[model samples]
Target: MAKDLQERNHLVRWGILIGLSFFSLATIFILIIDFEILRNPDITQDHHFRIALFILVIYFTIYATSGFIRYLARYLNNRYLTRFTALPKLSSYQESFTRSYFPNKPYEHIVILLHGFTASPQEFQFLIKHLEANNIPYISPKIIGFGISSTHLLSLAHRHDWYRVAIEKYDLASSLANKVSIVGHSMGGILATFVAMHRPVHQLILSGPGLHSAPSDLKYKRLLSLPIISSLYIRIVPYLPKPIRKGRQTTSDTLDQTHTGTMFQYLAIPINCVKEVFSAQDDVDITKTQSDQLTIVYGKHDLTVNMSALFQQLDHHNTPYNKMSFNNSAHNVLEDYDKEYCCQYIINLLKNPQKTNPISKLKKQSTTQVQADA
Candidate 1:
């Protein structure tokens, strides 16, 4: 399964190269043909040069704008967003959260949750409530470098810390419950896959899974996946590690496409962190997924991750998966308008763990059709 996904990733990389090639060829063809026909002999050589320069400037201007918005989003996330923390470390905050999500009761099933990148355990509160309402205990660990309480993110090295800590939480949950369910959102969705592959999980749920990546934000990743460029970068990255490559720290105030959790997320990633995410994703394999039951809820309009690519992953595994999507939601599906709907979906899945929901043959199956209006 991992091999197939790797091949698909390569296809995406080559597709970009192919598109650039065709665009360049077309541009050259137009300039040569147009030059011969119009042949502005009266126009000075500098006049033609200036026109080309102006076109280049416009193209680069738009590119730069898009890049700026992306970075600005990251900046705002690192600065303004509220961080939600949970775990043994923040034992002090437990008294407050307990009155809300953690209703004191005997536990049944244990739910282990992982939140999105630059997010905190708070993302799990809604789902956590559903679990507690059903007499289930849960442990939603804060990925080390995230949350408002964290201070070492800039100095932290890689995702290994996250994966290891997450596994530890899963083990703790396993000891506490008769059965275990794992849930992840966005970046956590990717990490959840790693645990589900090797651990004993009764069910697996991914909200806004990040398996599918947007081309524009992921363009820098292509440098590592591409052939000769990868070799050159490999030889050059050591001297220019994460800190230096991270450049200057900065923040932004808003994101163009709004969402409930956007403000809190760190939109900007250090170059090293980008490589870490890619490396982690580069290792995902469906064959390794050990769970007998899987449920994936994606937003039809999610901008952070591509749903089509993710759907293709499970479809290729031919593994039975319950695929659900909400029309009004975006990348942060877990925090969007349909959050209640998301909670209900988990409850339903847990109630019927053996039932299978197949991936759509033509497109993703919508929740309205699958669950039938609550």
Candidate 2:
């Protein structure tokens, strides 16, 4: 089976190479000179031809730059950031570790925190502190490709491994507590949903759940998964200053500009990991949730996820779920603005399950109205 897969991948690679080559050539030809319109008379005499040629040159340059952006980013990351950012020297604390704030107590509520891509359990520091203060026992498991600075190691982790880790943690929490509540951030949201669907989950909280995406964006993502393209997209973010170095800037300076304090390219997302996230979404059935079991919180200004698409999915599945949208917030909800309010909201919801909003309530009310009319 491995051999067959290998052969199939080989064929696919050849096909992609051929396709890209043809497309690039066609684009260049169309941009440079419309063969039907431009008859190659004299270069100097034909002003239109020269203008078209100049535009074509500019277009090619931009195209080449985009394709090679990966190599340039890799060079910059290795030179300016990785060495002095203090990442290769991972401290014990930087790695994954779990502790119960109030140990040795019969706990009825347990929270499982599944972190996001290329991030560690530390992502949930704020939430963990809250859980501790509330005397709630929780476990944060390390996904295989994370909690470390080794890029190659992180790149190798898959979605199955992430799910396995979550499942193991769930079992541990289940044995210790009467109810297991899952809180997932970003990619972690996908895992949380999976647990809620398959396991005996008491409550689920998703922070910027990265579940569904638009079909066009998904197609673009799949294209990025290709070898040459994926490599570039993985290592490059918008903030990285290309080949341009400021006056006497140290590695720390570069790190500061990119907001990568004390960590080596934390934003350097892995393609395999991304693929795994989308895979989890595709593999899981997220159409509906059990009564009062789910609460999804996302920033209204979240650039990564489509809130409309998510709401549409839930409505399509006839799923009843509670949702909250925060203003002036980005992807990470626990670390962003209004986090405290969200934390209190979660605490209140867990403490007072009766107040939880169920989408089905409106439907039930509508049904009652119809019966009265009939």
Per-residue lDDT over 314-343 for candidate 2, one digit per residue giving the tens place of the 0 to 100 score? 888778788876664556656665555556
Q: Rate the local accuracy (lDDT) of all candidates.
A: 0.64, 0.63
Candidate 1, poorest ten consecutive residues by summed lDDT:
244-253
lDDT of 1: 0.64
Listed per model in order, the count of residue pairs whose N, CA or C atoms clash below 3 Å is: 5, 0
TM-score per candidate: 0.58, 0.57
Model 2 ranges off by over 4 Å: 1-105, 214-219, 224-265, 288-292, 356-374
